[model samples]
Target chain A: MSESPQLTYAEIDRTILDTLRPPTGGYWLAIMALIMGVLLGVACWVYQIFIGIGAGGQNIPVAWGTYLINFVFWVGIAHSGTLISAILHLMRAGWRNPIARAAETMTVFAVSIAGLFPFIHLGRVWLVYYMLPYPNQRYLWPNFQSPLVFDVVAISTYLIVSSLFWYTGLVPDLAAVRDKATGVRKKIFTILSLGWTGKHEQWRHYTRGYLFFAALATPLVISVHSVVSWDFALSVVPGWHSTIFAPYFVAGAIHSGLAMVLTLLIPLRKIFRYERIVTMKILEAVAKTIIFTGLIVGYAYGVEYFLAWYSHSAVEIEAFRWRALGDYSLEFWIMVVCNSLVPLLFFFKRVRTSIPWLLGISILINIGMWYERFVIIVGSVAHGFMPHAWGLYRPSGIEYGIMLGSFSLFFLFFLLFVKHLPSISMTEMKETLDLGESHGD
Target chain B: MATDISVIGLFPDEQKTAAVIEAMSGYPWLIDRVHSPFPSHKIFDALKLKKSPVGWFTLAGGILGFFTGFSLAIYTALEWKLIIWGKPIIAWIPFVIVGFEFTILFSVLGNVLGLLALGGLPDFKGLKQYDPRCSGGHFGIVATCTEEEQDQVIEFFQNQGGEVTIFE
Candidate 1:
């Protein structure tokens, strides 16, 4: 009687719950860090409110600061999450399930958090709403022709679409949670579950709907970054105005995004005891992506220089020189090493799967990626076509605080998300694992 | 505590309803679909399902999305126009981005409306009747049968099986 042939629904549910609810020792510490990060960030935002965008590193020539760069960097990092999940799903890649939801959530949160920078960068944060072109009595309207306007549209679209993609995947899972949780949680899950009954028909639509979104999302991943590139390309700055900027920016986004995923997940897998879910195989796949995208990104760098030389445009040439040999020359070289050279470590299969090495490479890639944006934004702006407008760009503590705080904000939401949802799609993983068992051995 | 029931079959279309139906023909049981999975185009063949109203919703959404996208684009561009010494009203080419985004935005809205129309969700009542294994890909088909026919179902399933389990 005790040994029934099939698992009772109770047992199946319990097993799933047990797997996700791994005990946490330093849960409080992680929480504390998130709180501190938020406090620092809020303080900085308040300061920006009082002192204006000037409190950060915005001056005559370089109106953009670390906030904008961070915005771009975080958005780039966020891209890989949905892009990875969608690509894998399209390919019917079996490895994607465990990683998809986490990746999707990451995209949603990072993109949303990154969305704040453009607003924060506004001198009158109060008047930032003016960026929106609402038809009202004031009669002022947002410029549709501005690349920044395009950015507003693209970023919002990416955010909304990616979020729907994320939340759609969670409906059935939420129902599962609802069944298990009680009282307030049960009520909350029930509401969020949106009456998902795990019915035959619902599953039918859900799958097809998710797939359609995946197909749509793939090009979007490319477009969002390309749109981001256009933000720079549309500008008259010699360094920024290149045709290759779109694809170059796209590849770099993927490169840096892959690196960030690795950096975040290495610690995440360990802390959550998801070693099995985020297996060595998964790490190897990530390493391969890093290598693949890194090559494209590095080529973009070289191409920037070559184009500068080939076009014989001295203004572009000067900007290129400034990127490599100017005061920020050290950053330029480090970008080369970290983004291009350091990623070479992934060439070795051993190092790719080594957790510590994976973490180091990822951090390097992230830094390199940040510097890459800095080169485009600050480098191009500081040493513009008109050297008369040239100026030094320095970050103030307020800028650093906001940047650090955004990181905290991202993590805080992500951490809570993990605890609440099934971090890995339990059902999807079991289906993959069960594939081998079906051989009737 | 453990008995493995394995089914190896084809998912000819999205929702894999056809796969489930094919399996059902062989075993007389009450089958439950775990959750909706991807590859959508198979609603008719798999479960003999009706077409979704998502298209209608999508159309409505597309219209709404157009207004939202265009209004935002036009208003923003006009607001504090950087009067670049007299550049053309920030060319319409840039407005295309907003248009493209609105199209997709409305499409998702259509999907949500379609979902709500199909079923006002958070189905606590119906959820209790379903199985988690549905999400796991094993459309669990529970056969309520007498002892005599049990072995035959088992044999048929073995020839066409993967991860089969029995209760009682």
Candidate 2:
């Protein structure tokens, strides 16, 4: 019998926009857990504000603790969105369009969450914007060449561009929403969409323009992460001074970013019943990307050991030794197992296809990536060449609280975003299904 | 209706779509309506340029993004001097990265914003025309004409083997 049920675009759009409507069981719990974590994290931040930076971990040598760790972790995690949307777009892979928005959202949220770290760690959130180069009465200015300063510019640029890319792709979809919206949603969509009429000529130029922007964004990801790597490598510190830092960081960023993409998407696909658009095929492809990058990351770790041993530099050798069996040795071991070993599980096709395992691995990888950064930052600096100067880094409650809150903030934004937009490209899906219709004599 | 009108139909095919476009070059008031099972990318060259401002947006956005990026980097580095590796306070070469990232990011954003603005998207008002089928698979064409010249246009469309609809 021919299929009696024909789902229209309206139904799809409604489902996408209505993701948050009085959930039944699982979704409600997830949302609740996210909200609770965020609230608790906020409370922790409050506790930290009263007590100061002492609540967490930060000492003489290891000045950057979990706060900086989270910052680097999240930034690395943000790169895949641009990689997927821009690189895949440039490469003309059709599977990218559906998943790109989700990845890009992850990037923006991760970066935004990461961006707040400096302030959270600063113990002075109000003066954050004072980091901007505003010509003031004091004639104060910042050094233009610091990698951290470069990171500020790079991360901000990445955020703005990525946001615009994701939102711009949403214009037509937003227009459709505006058309169906009855009240405030309609007004919001209308304004956000800017009155898209979907004329043929417009579509023609739109595709061209979108493609152009994607091409532009592809390289930005490479540069942004390299710059982030430079923040450490540019320094004269023993562990941070390796020339391999750029490639190593880039590979690690991609590794973490892929994990983040899977972590966010696997659950979403299951919950929203988006199996058709974000099919198992798409997940499998992404799994392959993860595996490839995982290998790269594992290799990068190997390279680090090789260079340190081969270079015969005392400081490098000492840094490596400390990382493996240092005061914070546990973090280093966790990073190796989580980042290197867990990813190896993906080599089996069965493991890659299993959503539960993917989620587990993704979560573990993120944790591991965070640990990796901590190991790199803290392991090297906390106990330097001078034994007497060795000091432990304990982030104040504020730093730790903000770090936890950052994830909550990201989830909160994502939850709100999913509720307003069509998570899947309805039009694209329809186009895919219409091949038979086109062949009718 | 034009008394000299002619009607012709062709099986929807790319070769036919191309033929119709090629044949239309003969008629002064040439109007050929070609139907396709799907939207054809080739039709664009047949009908191009709708005055889009996305280019300007991208250029401006990229500039803004780069400036802000470099500016932010410089600002932050100069703000305090708690040496990490005992390096100098004014770190310049390292800051080049931040500047580069901002430039790419802002420009890309501008392009997207410009595209949105140019496309006139997010229009809430349900349009009068454009059946949902238009978004589906139908390729529709509306060729306007006077009663006297309708016959010539129809003849040209017919010779090119196109679907011609006549209404008064």
Candidate 3:
């Protein structure tokens, strides 16, 4: 809603398309670094595979370690993308037009990265196909009642739906690029654009399809995360088995995701010169939403402890108590401070509007979120019922390498996305221009 | 197939283009297609097109997906006859999550299919008559007419301040 007034339709197309210009030497250097990180992760995984799963610190008690934590963290990071692209579109938030594309791209990449952690966690990654429901000579069928099976269905559906929704939005913009490009680029865009010509007939069905995808995606986003939460909620672990896990996880996911969007977008806005399009108004709006979600997350934390006390169950009480006061208490406190307390700073307009403060808080919140999952997964599993079986879990070097690799892969995909495609929606920007012009008259 | 001989009018402003489209309502069939860089309800209203039936595809896909999800769960459970937690062999409650995900996934696929099919997309021939400016800031109206009416259509577009081109 706060786009620059002087922007013409031509300027919008040109400026957005300009972002796709050839990457400079610095860009390649960053890409090279990310590629190295990715290879290090791969090398670690290969070593783990050859040396056995025990090489990465998964003992009897703390079987689910940093891999699960990273899985939940990355998935949580993906939530805000759908919330922005689909939910905001449904709400008709005009401010979403410029930021939607970036958010959606993040969703695609984050989800892709998130999907990999399960396989990385699966020491025998080659056996992943067995998780799929298929007929075989063994006549073994995946249990439909299992939450793990639900994760497979939910995550696969999410990845597919998010990709479709993202591509559907990109079609017209690809056409705009196609028209501007020539030779190889033109041919590539022509195919990617699916021969879009922006005809009224195409727009008619395209709008309807886009709306339907958004509608479908809105519920899918909620359901996917809910399913992910059930992976723990359905368990008998004292800290994990709670009805509040779904909404609590969903809120925490959005909170972290909003932080990540800020984390990525702030630097992107500066580097890409998208300050006019992704303005202070938009950033402030995101920060405000972060406050609301952060509060919900904070409340969930309190309620979790309250429930532990209210249930009068000794194990549940001990689980909550040990989480805050035990070996991993540092992580627990960091999660609390970052995920809940940090966003409270945004209540003041000054903190909310300050670029440095916003960026710093966003990054801190992401770290807090990662720790939140770590505390829940490892802490709960480590300090479960029966003291003799209890043990603390530390992420071995391989685990850290894989986690770093996932982040590198995520960023590498995003960097490639920025260089190849129009990072902003040129079509929507032009529509805003037309609407603004009409309102002006 | 031979392309239709049409008179194309390119307008710089969307408002003027919508006005020209509205003025051409009397000769509705003469308007082959109106193009713009973005979707304009104004142009859509001027064209007076019927509502898209893409929702039907989505609805059908949802129903199909729901059944497919339930059937897979039920049939596989029945086939295995293995009850771990003493729950029912056909537990409808847990299957709802699977059905819900599939419903959304298939519905999205259907919507995309309907869009491509109904919109006549992947239309390689579309570029033949398309002006690149339409993808930038221009609005284009392609109207087809007989040889006699071509001159009149060109004159009409010119009068409406549109830059006209004839595709023969």
Candidate 4:
């Protein structure tokens, strides 16, 4: 096999910084669309808050509707960053270098979007602080046993740690930007860079700090999603209650997450002409990871069914059967076809290498994962122990608008981020280039 | 600190930079620091620097975070004393999640603080001594030398294929 061509330091510097230049008209169009989405979502949310919880489609039994579905969806989308940045870094996967920054950026924005849902879901959004464990006048504290409480700890910790990890990696690169920039731009980067000089002492300590953070972040990713799964599993709902939920959720999170990385990066690479940095090789590697995660998720799906039958509980059996042939059976099969079947196409090199196929599969997986949550949340709740109390949840326009807005919000933050910061890590890319040249490959 | 005039040398090549660092070790001039576009194991080995101690700070933060997380859970459970079902007030099993999360939170806090303390960041004082080329593709060597030894250091840098400048 032929080795990749060498890139000079100047080439690396110029090409990476090319991303930070003034935005094109296309960029403005994308940003405007995202902004519109956010505004519409915001308007819907305001209407809901003012009018009350009844504006949502949720009713008896199916109390968790599109809001919880969107919440879990965004949270799952946030997983790839830690997976690519921390776990892949620990594993010393070199292809991760080009995509780590974008993935981590996604993690931060996705979590921020996900964080808002808890408040949006709360009919009393102003009283959200009651979840905090504090000594109050009423002697009230959030119950430790509540999975919702675990969510607070897990998600906030994920957000903080991921932000720090992203910022820490930015220091050296920010200094590089500072060196190259002028006027107000220079001042901003200077402050943001925290006076990094890339000195040996600084690099030494910074390396150790980065390693420690990555070490911590790896387990944090698993824990955050596992805790999210417990929000369902800990409940007595037949479909929701299962010991396998943790691993199952973690796998599904990563499955959708890897696809998202592809969805975002494939277009990103083409838009920025980063064909060299985010090479076909890198895309292929990511596609491979997608395949692996897909299988694990598929296995989890299979295991869930097998365990349901093995339990010999009529309710568990009915729950699984209902999911397959129930009212929302269309969504259940859509999820199966999207998540499990479409990903198998990646086994072929042609499919893995094709951008259109990658994008299509990624979009499908995203929908599949979203519907997977829908099936899990709405499917189980709609068919309860008492047939008389069972209910079906059809999402209202307000709920749909808010969900669309969440997507727009996520993209809005990312678009602004892409405009201001270097989308790729400058220092890491240079290091990779230098290593390549050092070996004279 | 003002009395000690500093000399800075810029190297376009990594091999020459390594040689310059090694040469400075034998002279009376105190090698202040080396700046490269990226971290180099070769440079660190040539300088014979000690391993950084930032990990210890992270360990301390992690331990502290664990206790803090436990305290928040256990202490609050004890205070609230709202018995849900027949479960114990201090649910150690479920509380482990809190402690685990806290351990990560504090570890990062500690890591960042440790980085700031050890790296001496947020101070732009060193920006004056910094050569922007060092961040581009060049490697920089900063040495502290007396006026008497300045000529020898400059000649050494020139001989090693480096561009020399005095740090103002």
Candidate 3 Cα errors over 4 Å, as ranges:
A1-4, A436-441, B1-3, B27-29
Clashes of each: 35, 38, 0, 0
Q: Per-residue lDDT for A17-123 in model 4, tens only?
A: 88899999989999999999999999999999999988999988899999999889999999999999999889877778889999999999999889999898898
Give the per-residue lDDT of model 1 (tens digit) for A50-135.
Answer: 87777887888988879879988988988888767898789877656657777888899989998999888886877877876566
Candidate 3 structure quality by residue, lDDT tens digits, B1-168: 333679899999988998998889777337889889999888988888888999999998888888888889888888777866796899989989878888888888888889989999899888888888899999999998887677888899999999998887
Indicate whether candidate 2 or candidate 3 has the larger DockQ: 3
Candidate 4 CAPRI classification by DockQ: high
Predicted structure 4, TM vs. truth:
0.97
* Candidate 3 pairs with clashing backbones: none
Question: Model 4 off-target regions past 4 Å?
Answer: A1-4, A437-441, B1-3
Provide the TM-score of chain B versus the true chain B for each model in turn: 0.49, 0.59, 0.92, 0.95
Q: Is the docking of candidate 1 incorrect, acceptable, medium or high quality?
A: acceptable
Model 2: per-residue Cα lDDT at residue A346: 86
Q: Residue A176: error of model 4 in Å?
A: 0.7
Over the full model, what C-alpha lDDT does candidate 3 score relative to the true structure?
A: 0.89
Candidate 3 residue lDDT tens string, A127-221:
99888788888888898889999999999999999999899999999999999999999999999998899999999998888899889999888
Q: In model 4 chain A, where is the ten-residue run with the lowest total lDDT?
A: A432-441
Which 10 successive residues of model 1 chain A have the least lDDT summed? A432-441
Give the distance in Å from residue A106's predicted Cα in candidate 4 to where it truly belongs. 0.4
Report the lDDT of model 4 for residue B20: 77
